[model samples]
Target: MTRSEVPSGGPGADEYDVIVIGAGPVGENVAERAHASGLSALVVENELVGGECSYWACMPSKALLRPVTALADARRVAGAAQAVGGTLDASAVLERRDGFTGNWQDKGQVGWLESVGLDLLRGRARLDGPRRVVVETHDGTTRTLTARHAVAVCTGSRAALPGIPGIEDARPWTSRDATSAKEVPGRLAVVGGGVVGVEMATAWQALGSEVTLLVRGERLLPRMEPFAGELVAEALTAAGVAVRTGVSVEELNRPAADRPLTLSLSDGGRLECDEVLFATGRAPRTDDFGLETVGCEPGSWLSVDDTLRVTGVRGGWLYAVGDVNGRALLTHQGKYQARVAGAAIAARAAGVPLLETDRWGAHAATADHDAVPQVVFSDPEATSVGLTADEAERRGLRVRAVDVELGEVAGASLYADGYRGRARMVVDLDRGVVVGVTFVGAGVGELLHSATVAVAGEVPLERLWHAVPAYPTISEVWLRLLEAYRG
Candidate 1:
């Protein structure tokens, strides 16, 4: 471990080179970067070390859904039947999920921290002031740590429940509850047709819960192309997921007896379920972290400059990454931000002038602010990158779009005998470069990285045309998209 020679204490301080708050993927990357650069770093975390992705949001939800997706694929084959002699075991899945998440234990993660020489402070941390963090440990002692170089916040996000009548007092499940539950609800009503809600609904539906997905919008996944939403709706309907788009849950009522829950809708219909899961959206975890002491406020996220520096902090000693910055809430994007901020901090500390990259440079999180890629790991999955046509037009770009039935592609044909899918690509007419791409069908996740690279690299359509997608693969949609653009 590298030692700092000038370890002088300041206000309510214990000496450290860097102090990282939150032990999520982003925070872990920040600590690892700091330690790798020969700086003493301490990580303060209140929950499991691997963060929400490990236990609730990403990992467990995928655990619940993966088997369903696999089963769907298997059922497509001859003589490979599903849900006949075999059904999804919710308890076994949850048990396997717990094992994957290490049952909320930090021993394995703490071992990694120790290997990297990072001081592990297992507690909830609040920003006392600039360069000062106060942690109240589970053991009941409070300790203050002063950071010499920087204090980086990477605390992830939490499920945000939109204000509805009786929602606050009503017992409900969020992504956390839906993913961690050992038993599937008898009948589940998912409020919100976004990624998390749609995924959990499918999982529970496969696990023998009659699932209903309610959405206020006219279609599901309003964030993606309308065609993609149509595909998802079709898949959900086929799998017995009762999708209620263009409806609002006006009131949530509790029952004293059987089933226990019911929803009154604006459309004069009621949905009864054993449990309800809310996947309205996620909000940054910035409330109790004392952001005001550093000139930031609650409800608003931390303001960061191109270099990932907290805009108003003194001596360039404060940084914020991940969901707390209110950029991309995905775990991988957060880790990307942490890498940039960590490297920038280390370079600044060593008196080395930082070399900068473009919008995707170290520290900017430019991609998060603009073209972030997202994937929904559902049956007939959807993947997207960059700005859609509507967004481009709103941003004053003269955009041209090509929409193709995914079934037209050779790749879709290979995936299934009766493959149904949709594909769309948005192009910047002025620059003749691909700006956005969306693919919805079976096995589409494998196609997103190419789209990401195109958007990030600004690869021109002519050049991209020459970049051949592998034959007998779902990725041949790229060729179809480019040809449509050419015509």
Candidate 2:
């Protein structure tokens, strides 16, 4: 049946075996998994069905960056460098980004939801009580939905703007705006040195904007290894971005809509820019969702167990996945949690005992704690899996960190004229297994799954050595890292 013919959660169709709030990737996975497990499911979404990653955060942002990365890669090779053009075509890049987002339309996404046999409710959903949700539609109507088995919250998050004076009047850009803007600004000021800040700074600078990056911290990508941030900062600086650290916007003033913005810095400095983007952080989109009805604090992140079940909820009928639970904010990790939660809900409904105690079981989201992989798609990419060296040490585990330079690797040198990168592997001394690995360089994202496998599977160093990487490829970095660890 077409999406229009699907049930809209009215009257007799208001009840289902599972009701998933926020029809993003996480919610979609949960509903599909539950439905495939012989349970009826309904997904409620007030906005687009494909959610943030499809339209704003991941897809569009990547579309903007892909051209920049492609051009930079070409310039690194001698033969290709002579054939490349001077600068990117900003209009073409914007058009390509628009294509990725389907021009901000959700028709294709809605069709996919219909194909999966899940009912769609185009409305904002709120928790009415245990197992009950109230949805407000666009046309001044409300529908109450009751779940026979579970209610999963996957509302995700929104960009958080700082509480600077005149911030509201200044009209700063968020991640959404940075990715979806129709026209490029002449001068762009990017605040916060996290992934969004650096990535956008890279994209806009290459797209013809004079970009300035302001970071409150001492370095960028502070969550990763210190060297990762250092390398990325070096690259950004070389690319014409004014990278500033240990400073923040104290106030912003835009006298009028037609004029440039004047920003007052915390370090007694002033700057002017056509536009400013606040990439500081994200806040959970849990406010005004009627969470208080079920004793959950409104606007607070939900706490969950290994099974993705909300803690302290009496009946165990409530679950939260994705950014709302604050587990792992990445889209892929959220979908992983969705699958685990769906299985747990299905098992409980069918009177089958859940494998909550088993970390590797189908119903447990063990990777949320043990192995999480993330990549910062900067000029020189930074990717890591599992714990950092500092993180493992903080957990009281005796660990040794082995470092390798990518330029020393034959494969890396062959990939580019002057390949510059670094790799680190953190080994747990007691278990003789790999606990963490980080790679900072161009095209290192492709090597993350291998590191993830080693960390998550707790692969031993001896076993890893036998899994020899193919000769003269970036994967060979694994062999070098292992050799370094042995010595």
Candidate 3:
């Protein structure tokens, strides 16, 4: 065994079949799987049980944005706008968010864990060795835990603040502060045009904030296609968001209480705001976890193989799933990886030969490397799945694509008087599969699943034709996209 610095659970006295570090969705799923396999399991978490989505990421952002979307719809429809008076209740929106997230509680989640027979430890856990964990509890007690089967890490990610001069001194708000804020900033300067920044910008803008979005890239949603960016930019502009593209913030200076932020831009322009919100990226939380003692660095994530076992580490006992593994950052994908790791651990404990593949099997991280579906729930929501045209072409796929103005479809017209949306379908001509799908428009979230299923099932173009969209629905965009594919 490697000489380890991190401690374990009393030298096998409190050893379990499996010990899951981090009680986020992924870690919870891992413990659940171990219990289902008739193995004892324990899960440790230092923060709230539901992870970022519950409080700071997905849930709160959506709650904040929903009212604006609803208000916009009402305003567009003449009779509806007239009945609803003048505006949305910002206080009510915050209250609803607080109620759903349990005000950052793990009570219900802890109860559910107990009901499922998984032990819960409210503590910070670190790796002592390959199968050992030492936890420092919030109550000031240290407990060492050893896993007889496997030790899995599922700590999620944290917001990555950009490296701008004087940024830290300015005390900028990350997704953490922004999501759980008691008061929305009157004038917000959002640095980054990624999903989180854009969503927060939309929410605050709708909540009556004078929002200015600054991005280094020329277009919004650069991870997405240019067409999608164009559509979203148009929508954001229509919603009164000031978007400054191809610009970089050179410095951040804190001002007086009345005007808090001054951003010096590469364009030699200075923008002032009440607060600066950074939504650039996310880094995996692999630090201070004792990975170094086990031949892995704390800040660097563990590299895992097809079986989700860490590479360059012996005994095949250590595993990483979810954000900690640097795989797909989505909660669902992490849970999927946890299922694989959990099952693999159980099978190994039973002396069964490990099954391995990158598909949806018991040990595959296939979804991590493929078909990761993501959605942006802005006023004109955006949903995308699989690879893009450039990605497909780069992979040497003989590719063909089709783009359709969403208005061409009957569904778009029915959704609103002047519904402006765009849909693009990228096809792998050689494999006859839909490699990608992007939908950007109002009420487009519902339209994503069909495309996801098509991509996952690799349903052929001719076969997708049989999966007819309902008449006069926004989903008719799918039918139109398919027709454009052939044309």
Number of the predicted model whose lDDT against the real structure is largest? 2
Q: How would you encode candidate 1's per-residue C-alpha lDDT over 1-487 as one tens digit per residue? A: 1132112234544768899989888899998998899988888888877888988888888877888887787677555653435787778877888887788675777677766767777778888887989888777778878888899988878888878887766678998999888787788999998888778877888889999899899888888888888888889999999898889888887855344777889899988888889888888888888887877786567778766788877778989888888777788778878888888889888988866746776645677756789999878898899999999899999999898888878777766667888888899999988788898888888889898989877898889878988887878888888887778
Q: Which of the predicted structures, 1 or 2, would earn the higher lDDT when compared with the native?
A: 2
After aligning candidate 3 to the native by TM-score, how far in Å is the CA of 355 from where it should be? 3.5
* RMSD score of candidate 1 (Å): 3.3
lDDT of 2: 0.91
Error of 2 at 482 (Å): 1.1
**lDDT of each prediction vs. the true structure?**
0.82, 0.91, 0.82
Rank by TM-score, highest first: 2, 3, 1
Reference-based TM-score of each model: 0.93, 0.98, 0.94
Once model 1 is optimally superposed onto the true structure by TM-score, how far is the C-alpha of residue 413 displaced, in angstroms?
A: 1.6
RMSD of each: 3.3, 1.2, 3.9
Per-residue alpha-carbon lDDT of candidate 2 for residues 138-248, written as tens digits (9 for 90 to 100): 656788889999999999999988899999999999999999999989999999898899899989999999999999999999989899999999999999999999998
How many clashes (backbone N, Cα, C below 3 Å) per candidate? 0, 0, 4
Encode model 3's per-residue lDDT on 1-487: one tens digit a residue: 0111122335554688888888888899988988899998888888887777777887888888888888777666657767786666778888988877888876777777877878777778888877889889877878877788888888888988777888878989898888888887789988888888789888888777889988899988887877777787778887889998999889999865455778899999999888988888888788888988789877886689866788887787888888877877787778778888888888888888875554666667666665778888787888888888888788888888789999778868767767788888999888888989988888888888888888887888888888878897888888888777777
Off by over 4 Å in 3: 1-13, 255-259, 356-358
